[model samples]
Target: MELAISIIVGFMILGAIYAIHARDILSAVIAGGIVGYSLVICFLLLKAPDLAIVQIVVETITLIIMVAVVLDSSRVEAYGKFDRPAWVTAGTAVLILAILFWFLKEASAPLAPFGENSMRMADAYVNGAVEKTGSINLVTGVVFDFRGYDTLGEATVLVTAVLGVLTILRIKGKR
Candidate 1:
């Protein structure tokens, strides 16, 4: 698992560099998608299935949209040489990643390992309120019953994105 995660991270870093340095818009979009996919794999390896699922779905959609935009652009440039100043892009990305990893490490370092207590509560919820909530899955019970508002907000954001994209497409066609 660790080796897999390390490989994913290496790919992500390389993809970031390619995204910044590759002059072709389509290549840059693909590189960005690579980074997004890497992050999704990393999240899954870290045992965060829910986050991984959300990340994969959202990132895939985002990448598709970006690729569509790049395809629609009139100017199609060849993939150029790595022309960006390497130091600037690499340093900034590394610094940002380091800070983000540091913060997550600190945040998770103090978390208690899951044990019987969590299981017992989950079982209790399942046995007690599963039918009442009309949710056969305990995870759904927790998400909809406990975090429904957050889900609502996420749906709102998705709706907003669709509207924005439609508006932009319309404007693009007119001009």
Candidate 2:
């Protein structure tokens, strides 16, 4: 599992590098999506399906917006002079992101192995949540009943983001 995560992180690193140096906006957006989706895989492997689902949905929405913006405007290369300060800033940001990811991995190391959970509450939720909530699916029961308000907020945010993207695209189409 460690090997798998390392490989995925390696790919993410490559994607980030490509995104930073990509000549065209579209290729950069695609490379950025690679990094985001790679994060979803890492979250899944770490036994955090909730985080994985959130990451996947957010990443998908972001990728869609980025692609739409790129396609709607310009096909030209995104760089202008590519100065030394830009390189330094990009490098610093990547370094910060890498350090944060390292801390996250270290912090989660003591938790259960990949695809396994150490929490007793998880078992209780899985076993009896459906019966209590009267939902056919365990996931539905947990999300809609147990975590109702939280789920509602997340859904609202997603809907708002998508609607914003659609509005932007529609406005661009009129011109």
Identify the candidate with maximal lDDT.
2
| Tens digit of per-residue lDDT, candidate 2, span 4-67 | 9999999999999999888887898999999999999998988778789899999999888789
Instruction: State each model's CA lDDT, in order.
Output: 0.81, 0.87
Task: Report the error of model 2 at residue 24, Å.
Answer: 1.7
lDDT of 1 at 148: 88
lDDT of 2: 0.87
The candidate that wins on TM-score is 2
Measured against the true structure, the TM-scores of the candidates, in listed sequence, are: 0.56, 0.58
Error of 1 at 60 (Å): 4.0
Q: What C-alpha lDDT, on a 0 to 100 scale, does residue 129 get in candidate 2? A: 69
